[model samples]
Target: MTDKETYQRFIDWFRRTWWDLPESVHLHPMIETYLTPEEVDLLTNIPHSSQGIEEIARTKGMAPETLEPRLRALANRGMIYESSREGSVRYRLNDSFFAMLRAALWPGRTDEATKNSAPHINRYFLDGWMDQYAEVHLKGLRALPIDRTIEDKREIMPHEDVVHVVDDKKYFCVTTCPCRHRHNLDPDMPDCPHPTEVCLHFDELAHYIVNNGLGREITREETRDILKKAADSGLVHGVSNWKDGVDTICNCCSCCCMWFESFHKLGHSASMDASNYRIQVRPETCKACALCVKRCPVDALQLRVSPQARNKFGKAAVLDPDRCIGCGVCSHKCPSQSLRLVPKDQAELTEPPRDPREYMKHYLADRKAAAAKNQNTAD
Candidate 1:
């Protein structure tokens, strides 16, 4: 196919894929701004290898200045990356984007109906299954342990800083995974657009262990022991301890954490799902102690009791499962040990419900209603 035809096809595919994402998550303006027809053609038709801007511009019959901004913009948005060699820059699409494109264009791919049905299946059956699946399938993956012996901990290291040790055998660190950092492209800055790619130093295994908390079968003490070893090995910074069924490890630095960054940008409501479970507090066993209230990361716990009836321990803690992420942070702090993470089948992970079509309907209706209300007010 011609370069222009190839580019058009890719853009159509991207738009269709983008529509699948909720309206709440929109692409950066820079991405939209630089996705010109010519640029699109270049990106789609360009071979699966890096090409210098001058060569690309010359071949495409575009000026360097005209092409440079578009190239930089694409690079910044994590859609592409630039490599410097001999004072010239070569641009290539990020691996994640390329992979997605390939999958979208692959012959005999599943129909759109199957793709649309996936979320429903995931929400109902695959929610809890993913954790187990990831564990079983990925447990053998290698990762470098942060070198605790290194005195200078201040330097920002890539994911490769650690060396993987399995069965007392050391292995060379490798970057073989695609993370969110590789796919997110911010449009605001053209020259240094994409977020820093530190995939090489990211400790995915550490994150998985922390999130999964050793296992559901293990005791808190056993989990704590594992965390302590991880900390000692320099894999985790700060307090590396286990509480309840959750492992609480101090993850320092802002850029390294997806959860922290999501929490910062979108608030706790946006960051976590109300676990497919709810925490229950036994009032009789609960000494009106408010320990659980303080430990809740999302402020899902609150103290409630009449002032006259309040004992020396003050008000009892109550859990609002709607805001809980099932991290189980609250269970550790209860002095009376009244709080327990109990499974609640009724609770869902997503808000306004999980049906994408219904969600879109409601979202669109809400927007229309709000606009009408605004117009009425103006009148």
Candidate 2:
């Protein structure tokens, strides 16, 4: 097919997929002038590239005046990026925005033709779409997980029970889990190297369990342990409810943390990658202080009696990788930094276990079946 024909096909797909419609009434005349339905189609059809406005306008047969302002609007809405090279301004679709559109358009689909089909969907989305508003919202919290320390007073609420802690001071919730998408970095951190980002939702789901009457209270200690286990297992980072009085915890990674704003723009989202790695400790560096043993959120870390000859430390901490989530919280607190985040290199990190198309096919099938069931119930 000709490039224009191919482009038109993509536009049709985008329109059907996102179901985005132009505003019925234009609040701004300038915005109205540039944001014609055709232009919107063009914008959506354009590949995620660094093409200058002139090139885009020429390709679309649009005048500069007609294109520039509309592009600005999309940029302001976080749909695309405005970039410059050698005094020339260019535009590209924002990764997160496109990902959201793709997700919305291709619900239940594991893959898109244009998107990077990585296992860590959440991390990839955040790395491409995170914004400052999200950062400000997160930074305003108090009582985050204590990094690199052991506390005797860790608590867990029952499955459905929630504890509220009102502190005179607010604390920032940061994590060492790999789910965080580091947007403001010099180089954007790729999505979770492991599946650690997906656990955030599950953590939130756990809180929903409480809200929906699934379980009773869980303690702060228990929450930490759960997050640690998820991280070690390469699950997403998660925390208990914050507005309801629980301390805020984060799932973070050194590579893609939202807090690392100066780095490449990592998209922001409420999702995480699937976890794959686990945490390990060097016994020699582990002091009998039992900081890791006590701080472990998942109960994966245990204090074992050391043999006299083998006892570099009177006691050593042992880790069960199977139960670990690789959040790297242990690494942050180890007095010797003996804890390390290790990838399960044997497992696939960059590639999906199944084709995204196949996954999507199954997902669509399930959705269709569910819809039919609902229809039957209504009938």
Best by lDDT: 2
- Number of backbone-clashing residue pairs for each candidate, in the order shown: 13, 69
lDDT of 2: 0.41
Q: How big is the RMSD of model 1?
A: 17.1
Q: Which 10-residue window of candidate 2 scores lowest in summed lDDT?
A: 159-168
Find the 10 residues in a row with the least total lDDT in model 1.
132-141
TM-scores of the models, in the order given: 0.33, 0.33
lDDT (Cα) of model 1: 0.38
> Which candidate should be chosen as best, given TM-score against the real structure?
1
TM-score for candidate 1: 0.33
- Cα-based lDDT for every prediction: 0.38, 0.41
lDDT of 1 by residue, 212-245 (tens): 2211233334334443443332222221111111
Alpha-carbon RMSD of each model? 17.1, 19.4
lDDT of 2 by residue, 116-168 (tens): 32222334334332332232222211112223222212332121111222121
